[model samples]
Target: MFYDKVFFLGKILLHLSIIYFMIASNKIIYDRNNYSDKELISLYKKLVKPRLIEEKMLILLRQGKISKWFSGIGQEAIAVGVCNALSTDEYILPMHRNLGIFTSRNIPLHKLFAQWQGKKSGFTNGRDRSFHFGSQEFKIIGMISHLGPQLGVANGIALGNLLKNNNQVTTVFSGDGATSEGDFHEALNVAAVWNLPVLFCVENNGYGLSTPSSEQFKCKNIADKGVGYGMESYIIDGNNILEVHSKVLEIAQSVRVNPRPVLIEFKTFRMRGHEEASGNKYVPHNILELWALKDPIENYQNFLRKENILSEELEVLIKEEIVHEINEHLRIAFAEEEISSTTENEIAGVYKHIHFIEKKPNQNTTEARLVDAISNGLDKSLEVFDNLIVMGQDIAEYGGVFKVTEGFLKKYGKDRIRNTPICESSIIEAAYGLSINGFKSVVELQFSDFITSGFNPVINLLAKSFYRWNQPADIVLRMPCGAGVGAGPFHSQTNEAWFTKTPGLKVVYPAFPYDAKGLLATSIEDENPVLFFEHKALYRSIYQEIPEDYYTIPLGKAKLLNEGMDLTIIAYGLAVHWVLDEFKKHQFSADIIDLRTLQPLDVATIYKSVKKTGKVLIVQEDTLFGGIASDISALISENCFEYLDAPIKRIGSIETPIPFAKNLENLYLQNDMIIKEVNILLKY
Candidate 1:
């Protein structure tokens, strides 16, 4: 009986000791001397909401109610503090684990729950999952899976804000692992060089998946790299909610006045695994215990309670209210429709506004080279649209490698015509950011072969964003491609087929000056990403009398260059010029069709010509295998096979890399190959 009494006394003492420690351990690390009592309580509530919601999400995941959960349980302080510090008009691009950003922005709880479950009422309308969707109304942009690319996107938004002189700043987030990506460095360099108003945040959460920071990067701190990029940077304790809030709040306001990029590295930890399913086996037990002792929510609650701003009863009441609200939102989201009403699976028009619209001014004419015609198209577009921006390397002063933008810098100010560093991927990302906003951007690649470096943003982001979120990307990529200029393989490539297969992109390859000017105008007016290919050889070699006024040609329409009944010759770019020259030289009785737009191929024209002639010959400047010629030939065979007298024939460059020698370059993708192929098709 005495031993049992001693044990009960010991238990009582242990409980009392924990209570005493909770009160005594609430140290004033970051004094909240400036904020009022009401404000302090409100900040504590903000810190509590996301932790509770994330815990509930994990519970749902365990019960198999939700497919996945990315826990931000421990890192709540940074998200809440940073979001509360920014102004409502400033834009934010958040990573996957930034639930507090959505909640602090006052996004409707029900809509966010629906988005996680992919319901019809979500921001993306059941298109994406979790925090993968953004709300423009809230001034938030969602990050794609590649976290580093969003930095460049933030650059674009900040650039737009600077040009408008709205005194607004932009903020973007990423983790320590993402700092190792090339886009991270490129974005900082671009932002610093342009002096854009942006705040870049990095949360060093000890580990990226299973890999620790030591293995990922050799730098002492992620913020240290900003010095090399010529930007101001800082390091802060992310666990201190008040400190995070006060520092960011001050920097955000000051950045609006100074208008430059700043990098802030928040030293924090992910108390949970990368995702709930991944488990925290990689982290040590002692380390976890150490971090748990520094929990942001618990510490903030302790601080508030010690300062007499929050009572125990009030804290419990706040949690109860938040839990009830979340439960109600979850209940409503569970009952909401998970798909669109118009279709069983939501595949809306992947790309809209594709039909060609022709615009012609008075018949005033002037002889101009293809390059001059392109310049005229851009000059006219810039004159008409005040929000248009042109960005590329050597474009501002040097006028581009092809001199296409020669006088643009002098005419338009530096903001309208800007030169970028040798960064294709990040600039493309910036262009995408501008495109989604109320601006149309034109990005030029010095050589078409360089498209490979920027392929991800085009294919994964720009090409699919419209279908995924109904956000149109109003941008144009000018590609200088083709052989016979002796630029070697790295510079010359007929790569239209690379983008022709993409759904949301439009491919425009014009053969002459008149077509180049008109087609460029049509492309500029379209609200989708357009891949405008210009053959380097045809830039100066081809001259024609084009209308000196602003005119646009039909996008998906084919031009019937010549008419006959013997054979149908279909071509584009340099191949069209080849067929035209061949017909003039040999006087062959053939129907010549110039496919001005390669994507929405003029099926009616091609079919009619093939049916009348009973023979067809397709040509391209790309290699013989897997070119647009193959798709055109297959389509002709499938639909117009019965009308054809012989199997369809094609002429293209041999399946070999473009050579540098003048003799070899002249023979490569030569026009002489078309005559031989046409003769065989006519005889058969």
Candidate 2:
């Protein structure tokens, strides 16, 4: 009993420290006469509009009028206050609950309702879920379902805007649950390091869905988490409109000038369930009753009455006007047509292609290796395109692992030749941010294997941005891939299959110095996000005299290396060189087709070759199973069946991960394996 008393007392002390040791949690910035009657009334209208919309949405959700809704019933003040503070030019990345952001930004009410209804007129053309659409016109970056990733995107926006010399701030929102995510921490650290102009707000609504703060975090407040990153933080009464408005407005104005990040923890609660359909039985009735009495709408109304700025009659008229507006918009949205089910219409704009001025193919008579060729391409691209920005780890001073960007720092300066932290995801997403804001960015991954660290932003956000909202991710991700030279499994991987399966991304795999130079140039110019794969083994192995001047090769087009009718050999990257080497040893009359781009697959060239040869062989440095070889093999067997005289063959590395030891690595990826398979196909 004595031990229990001591533990309880310690717990009480910890709780007291959490509340009081915080960076001034209970600061009152909102004065009684903070605004004149006109200003007060405007603030109240902005605060109440979302409440009326959410209340009506709950009714629609229950009656099955809408498919889903994540009601922000009690937390209207933060969205309104922050958005009110930001100018129309500054961007805001709001979460699912921040409906007031749209209303306050003056987004078309009918279109928002149409988006909720999944109509064609919606912002995302009904491709995205409700409240997950952006409007570039309004400077609103729509929130994704994975809430934490948006913080990194916000960093990208701020980063891009900073480069543009635009004095604009980007504000992003997340909940307490998202604070536990790595993105939140990484984004904050990046913002602090770069001194980016981003206002990070965490609406500490006491819960994330049904999970309480106790389960979500151990920190005193979400704002306290920001203090760890050396960012200024404040916790204010999120329920009070005056406090949220005044505090957020002041911070935003300050952030716009000073150019740094700030974290605000708005103290509020979820009065309703997470959504209308989800029950809230787990919440204690006492806690629910307490939050209900501190309702944001009710408290703000009382604050209005206390100041004598709004009478009961004026309040009723304001509410009636809001309801009428919502109803009038819903009437138009309800009559709007749903998204079309046609095949062509559905797939249109799912992938985008950008036009570029095709540079004349010129041979400047420069002897270069594959790595040198890549550097030449990037050099020429930077020289030609003023909007081009390059970022990677050690690429600035160290000039990258392969020295591809050697002397680039001296050539381009610090802004263009950026060395980034090991945070891959944040940089990739920031590239996306740059692309959307009228800049083209090229991001170099340290290795193809490390792409997993930044996979979410690539696949989920950049891959889907254009499809969802016509947001162009005009960025190139230079991925050094493949096995050999004892780099081992972790650094050596030919991972093109992972992205070829995913739409909205272009895959470029070039063999030899000439193709490498040309394809890198084109990949940078292409509007879509491109995965430019350069084989590590071939970086300096082969040499050729190629064009030093700028050139552009179209993506998805294959080059015929050596043509013959006896057999066809299909390959890309290092595999293409292996075939050429085998040809040097023995004169095998076969059509060697180098697939420069993998995603587009150049099926016409492939099918034509297979038809002429009537027997084909596909080779890759990657493992056999679930690779692009299997897909191409199937395509040939299905379409070129009648033309084939023998079974279509394929050769790839051993299934196990690339080994560390030289002998085991040889067994893992053997070029002689190609010889044995090629012989079998020719003999058959």
In lDDT terms, which candidate is top? 1
lDDT of 2 by residue, 1-684 (tens): 999999999998986565554424433234654578898889889989988888888888878888998878778988998889889888889988899999999987999999988888899888887878788899999878777788988888898888888788999998887888888888898889889898889988877788899898887778888878899999988877877888888888787778898888888877777776786787887567666766777777787788788899999999999999999999999988767777786666777856666677765568999999999999999998998999999998899999999999998998888988889988887887777678889999989899999999889888888999988888999999888879887998899999998888889999889888988999888888999999988998989988868898888889999999889999999889888899889888999999999987899999999899998999898898999999999999888899999988888998898988888888887778777877888888
Task: Report the Cα RMSD per candidate.
Answer: 4.4, 4.7
* TM-score of each candidate structure, all chains considered together: 0.94, 0.94
For all candidates in order, the CA lDDT equals 0.88, 0.86
Pairs of colliding residues, candidate 1: none
The numbered model that scores best in TM-score is: 2
| Cα lDDT tens digits for candidate 1, 171-244 | 99999889889889889999999999999999999998889999988989988898898899999789889999
Off by over 4 Å in 2: 1-30
Q: What TM-score, to 2 decimals, does candidate 2 have?
A: 0.94
How many steric clashes between backbone atoms does each model show? 0, 0
* Model 2 lDDT-worst window of ten: 21-30
